[model samples]
Target chain A: MTSTSSPSRKALSKIACNRLQKELVEWQVSPPAGFKHKVTDNLQRWVVEVVGAPGTLYASETYQLQVDFPEHYPMEAPQVIFLHPAPLHPHIYSNGHICLDILYDSWSPAMTVSSVCISILSMLSSSTVKQRPADNDRYVKNCRNGRSPKETRWWFHDDKV
Target chain B: MAAEEQEVRMEVEAVQAVYGDDCEIIHDFPPHLHVHITPRTADDSSQQFVEAILGILCDAQYPQKPPHVHIVDSKGLDENREKHLITTIENKAKELSSCLMLVALCEEAVELLSDMNHPEGNCPFCLYPLLVEDQSGTFAPFMKLMSCYHCFHSECIIRWWKWLQNEIIDSKQCDSTISTSAGNQREMEQQQQQNCPVCRKLFDAKDIEHILDYAGTNSSQPTDVIVEMDGDERKFLECESENNRRQQFESLLKLQQENSGLIEPRKEIVVVPGMYLPTTVMPTLAAIDAADEQHLDSGSTAPEAVDLNIPSNKATTSKHRDMNTRRKNRNHSSRRQPNVYPNRTQWIKKEAVSSDP
Candidate 1:
């Protein structure tokens, strides 16, 4: 296995790299409020730290988000997942895969890592309960072979939370 | 009272007479109507970025009471512009006082719109000025998606378009392979309608095809693009700092492997240390969670929370991973703030200037 999970994809295309770098610069100028980008030289991957909004159920809690960008980045959605001990949330699973649509099918090129982070934080902020998804065990087991979350055909629940 | 009713009816008829198809009268009494306004471009939307339909509803007291004018619908205007338009109309209503100001308010909106009728702020793609104002007379060219007036720099949009087309072709190839059931969804999205990068509005191939080869959107920018592309590719892998960071990340991974009892290496999918059968898993998972808390308490080895909760002194082990503003700037392409959006963004600039001390 390639040390990294992005073997199914190619290297960041020239345009994707260019666009991501632009995102990086913009992130520094004004990062999404409740999230901080953990500096990594890996242009294709970003590890950002997120804090729960003050009044949210996950308040004062911190979580790590690992975002892996595909070669066709803006055209394709990034693979975003939480690191284990994933903030116990209904949409986030035990294995760290987040069931967020923008991280998958609904991603738009105009959206940046900052926007996605904001969306994730909002998702956490709106969460009324802190627990794993009902099928956390099954989902984690299915991902035993290290299938990227992008491979899972997620049926996005309505944006209720 | 009959004469006053006649006067109201006459005013309603006058609104119909002037605006014709552009006006929609909701009620004849007291004249509640919606007026569609476009700048003086002879209906050439390609040159137009803003348009609005205004609703004006006058009470039965007629001219003695001012009508309520509000933006029924608008496009290409931000919150500030919308507020500006409403504020101006309210002030205009007060100026007209007891006069029939429906038509006057509509006129003011059209004039105000024309003044703000250019694409403003940043291109959704690169987050840079869609129309840069450089004296070199060689700024990046930009265009709007016809389906929606959302605009982008020619190169930025074209590059995204090319990637989309490539993705479609790639997915088509996957239709015959081990690709998941998403193949059907892929086939459906395979049609000529690609989404607007900004609004997700579907746009046709022709929207981008015209600029596929713009004889180059800018001579200097293209060369800069090529050099940057090569440099970025190299920078991601072979650059000294990048290799160094890769090593650091590797060392962190190795550290995670060594401390696998406390934390899991998410990327590796290695069997979780305390993970076992489900019947007996709960208590152990709880124990692991406690171990996790203790590890977090120990610090450094705790991925990001360690960095956030205890940023400075506690991160001495991975001091390089600290969030320095300069380090953040170095990893990406620096997009400058929108200082001068020469046209449509003038209101934003105006707001900033007024807010400044």
Candidate 2:
């Protein structure tokens, strides 16, 4: 979450590459529930398909998450946002930006792609009402230049879904 | 109840006595107790990897039923190990089902702990085995954060720790909200504390002090073999531990030395900085660098001459490779200040004045 407005995108460090490869293998062995990774030659960016849990309001609905890792990854949180046609949830903006703490300020190096997916799924599952954020339009306007969610100085006020 | 209330209270007291302060009585009637159990490390926490507070609950049935045992709190035990501890204790209770087996159950818990006192699984950071030997048939030393028994391969954790330090500094600089409000030194001191990569527990710099060298600081002047060959630095990386590489280098140096007439080590001394200062480079207990100089200059361990043949361990150390290398270097002697100068001067003078064969 080292957001300096510099659009930080660099190749993964050797350590980061090793960690991601290991994570991919681990994800294959035991992927988190309700998430599937679209494997490609690219190790830097991951496109994960998320299905809302069965018992939740967003159940049976599918959404794609575009996760972009910075050079440092885990040390720096990945840029996680939904693809076009993001799910309808209070915390998720219409422009596919999901406002979650873990994706930003609350990120810890301990978290892996699997854990982040689980958190996102839990966020989607816990949504009682399907609606975009109150200021989705304005936020989307600001981010219309294809800004990463990591660039936002996000204030994570809401915890309960 | 088969056993009287007074008898049950007495039994709980006995359990407390046996475990001393480790046993905590939550309630007296049914003997709901919490007992802290550790492996048989003889109170040496460094040797201990797991500890748990077992929550034991008993019903009004007294000795007619067994107590409910679960792990109330634990450190170093992962989810699987925690479940195993609980399951085994629960089974032990079942076996001692109808009897006053409070103390016996606690002992069983201890026995389980003693059996499972080792750190297992891959390092959280590297996703590599914590206790396994590598392709080189040597084990990469692993250690645990003292505060929380979260274990990691020394190099792996050190690598993460270094990365984290850089990230913190980068983020702090980027965070302009507090720009210049807090002095940089104070801010740095506050941020110097790092979280355990596995548990997120705050650990002191001291927690990793022992394993710092594993990142190849090579602080201590090793008497190990310095490889005579050059430019195959990639081979150095392949060696398991620095120890194995040192041995490999020593044997290679020996092969060259025994064929002393065939290969002159004095002419081809390859000084890998912060690496491979084979004290055994000298045939006798003479100044290692001076001996090399002896062949060329007939033993002049002058600081300049010796400096070329013997790159001080400090010169070769890669502080830049380690982000917080400068901080760790604080414990070391001055980087350029050669500690071997005095010894070399005397040794070189003896050989030089005595005149060569």
Number of the top-ranking candidate, with TM-score as the measure: 2
Worst 10 residues of 2 chain B by lDDT: B347-356
Candidate 2 local lDDT, B1-357, one digit each (tens): 444788888899899889899888898887799999999987877788889999999999867788788888999888999999888888888887777899898888889899998888888777767876757665666777777888877656655655554444455546745644234434434443676666667876546644443344332321111111123433553457844745565566557658874432231123222221111111332233222322222112122332344444353334224312322232222232354333222111110111112
Q: How large is the C-alpha RMSD of every model relative to the true structure?
A: 24.5, 15.6
Compose the digit string of candidate 1's lDDT tens values, residues A1-161.
21125423467766678889989998898888988888878999898998889988988888888888876667677878887668898888877888988887888879988888989988998888878888878888777666778778898865877
Query: What's the residue-level lDDT of A120 in candidate 1?
Result: 90
| DockQ, prediction 2 | 0.25
**Cα lDDT, model 1, residue A94:** 78
Q: What would the C-alpha RMSD of candidate 1 be, to one decimal place? A: 24.5
Q: Candidate 2: where is the Cα deviation over 4 Å?
A: A1-8, B1-3, B171-189, B218-357
What C-alpha lDDT does candidate 1 achieve relative to the native structure? 0.65
Deviation from native of the Cα of residue B96 in model 2, angstroms: 1.2
- lDDT by residue for model 1 over B162-230, one digit each (tens)? 445445545455454554334433443343467777777787644554444242222111112111122
